[model samples]
Target: ALAYAAQAFQIPCVVVIREDAQLTKLQAIRRYGAEIVLVPLAEWQQRLELEQQRRNLHLVHPFDDPAVAAGQGTVGLEILDAIPDLRTLIVPVGGGGLIAGIAVAIKAQRPNLRIIGVEPEGAPVVSESLAAGHPVAPSRLDSIADGLGAPYTRAFNLSLIERFVDQMRTVSDDAIIEALKAVAQQAKLVVEPAGAAAVAALLADAEIERPVAAVLSGGNVDMDRLGSWLTR
Candidate 1:
């Protein structure tokens, strides 16, 4: 998305991606003419900051900046516009920006509505942070959902999530794959694992109330991966 925006304005954009980031996502960024810097998964956050400082780049942080969160809030507004009577919102969380932004927007207009966040079990940083009542960093991030493998949530994002979100749940890779298959077969949506996290939670739990909506956030999986998972 940032790459596309930069392309629109004809600005040079550099994306610092984890070494293990999805090949499809890397290809997409390159297609938008963005320069890519691959950093080790453990050092990505530090390298991103250093790169910004060294280049004097105008950093559009993935989840930390208020401006980015505000932009993501538009998704919430659109959701309400489409479903005014929505009782529950299920959002997939990585660094918590998207869910934070959505929660703020939805809670402002509909405080009574429930907002739930879903995270990959392998990298449930948001879930752990919320449980600890503070920001918590995961020791390691190991998930098929590369987009949902954030190592930690920043304080600002965590605060917003704590304030507005009602619950946080996690789904295993198996559950996520199952949900991805279901979405493809039933909903005819070819979604990536991160995109299916919310659906995974919804399918795993039967107690969630009616009028629920799950955000499908991406569809940039490698074809080989999709084929392998589908055949499995």
Candidate 2:
């Protein structure tokens, strides 16, 4: 989305992506005319910092920027507009921005509504941070849902999540894949693994409140791996 926006405004966009990122996502970014730099996992941060400094590019923190979060808040507003009687909202958490934004917007109007965040058990940044009562980064990320594999959390978004979000849940890779398949087969939505995290949580736990709405976050799945994921 950011890359597409930059393309529209004729802004030069340089995206520093992990070397292991899904090929389809990379292709999509390139289609928007952004320069792509694939960096190794261990050197991504350093490479990103150097690139920003060299090009004088304004770093758009994926999930930490207030403006970004505010923009995401529109999703919450739309949900409220669509489902006025919504009792529960389940959001997939990557760096907590989407859920933080949605929670603030939803809670402002519906204080009684329950908001839950689900992430991969392999990359449990939000769950761990909530447990420790502060922002925390996992030592390593090991999840199929790379979109939800944010390595760390910052205080800015963490504070909002801690304040507005009701609970954090972790779902296994298997559960996420199953949810992805179910969504494709039943809901007719070809959602990515990260997008299905919320549904995985819903399917895993039967005690969640009724009239619940789960936000499917993304749909850029790697086609090369889709067959194995579904058949396995």
Candidate 3:
């Protein structure tokens, strides 16, 4: 979708993906003539800053970008339109982008709605930041949810979440795997571990009530890992 959108707008876009991303993604990028930059885990932040500085890359905050946030907020809009009595929303947190965006959108429309964030137990930047009342980087991050493995939470996302999010929680890698399997087997959807965290929380007696909506963020996962997780 991003590639197509960029092509439609005649934007020269490069996709910076993790080193271990699927080969299909690489093939697709090459097929579309989009530059693909592979980033190693240790050098991700440095390379991101370097790319931003060198390329004058327009950094789109997943949650803080108004347009992106507005689009995410539309999820809240649809949810409310479908179920107006929604009291709470639980979203997975990476750099705090999606939740931050959703927080703003939901709060703007329904000031009293409860919004919560879920993070990997190994990479609990948001939870730690919220505890300290400031954004903080985790010493180390280890999670199967590649999308939610951000070592640090962004300032904008942290500020918004601190202000608008009602609570934050962390889930174990084992729990995330369980959630992924459940989503695949029961829900019949191929959701990545990060995307399935909300369902994991729901299954773990996390205190969320019925009639709540969990954002299944993304479906990108390695096939090998997916098979291993399913067997386990």
RMSD, every candidate, angstroms: 0.9, 1.1, 2.3
Measured on C-alpha atoms, candidate 2 has an lDDT of 0.90
In terms of TM-score, the best-performing candidate is 1
How many steric overlaps does candidate 3 have?
0
Comparing candidate 1 with candidate 2, which one achieves the higher lDDT? 1
Tens-digit lDDT string for candidate 1 (1-232): 9999999999989999998878999999999999999999789889998989999999998999898999899999999999989999999999999999999999999999999999998999988888888888975588899889997889999999989999998899999999999999999999999999999999988889879999999999999999999888
Summarize candidate 2's per-residue lDDT along 1-232 as a digit string, tens digits.
Answer: 8899999999999998889889889989999999999997668778888999999999987898898999999999999888888899999999899999999988998999999999898999888888898987775599999998887888888999999999998999999999999998899988889999999999988898888889999989888788788887
Segments in model 2 whose C-alpha atoms lie over 4 Å from true places: none
Better of 2 and 3 by lDDT: 2
Q: Lowest-scoring 10 consecutive residues by lDDT in candidate 3?
A: 60-69
TM-score of each: 0.97, 0.97, 0.89
Per-residue CA lDDT of model 3 for 1-232, tens digit only, reads 4566677788877776678655645776676666777998668667766877799877644344667766676777787898888887888988887787778888988998888789988888888888888888875587877778886776777888888898898889999999999999998999878899987877787567667888898786778878999999
Between candidates 1 and 2, the one scoring higher on TM-score is: 1
Candidate 1: stretches off by over 4 Å: none
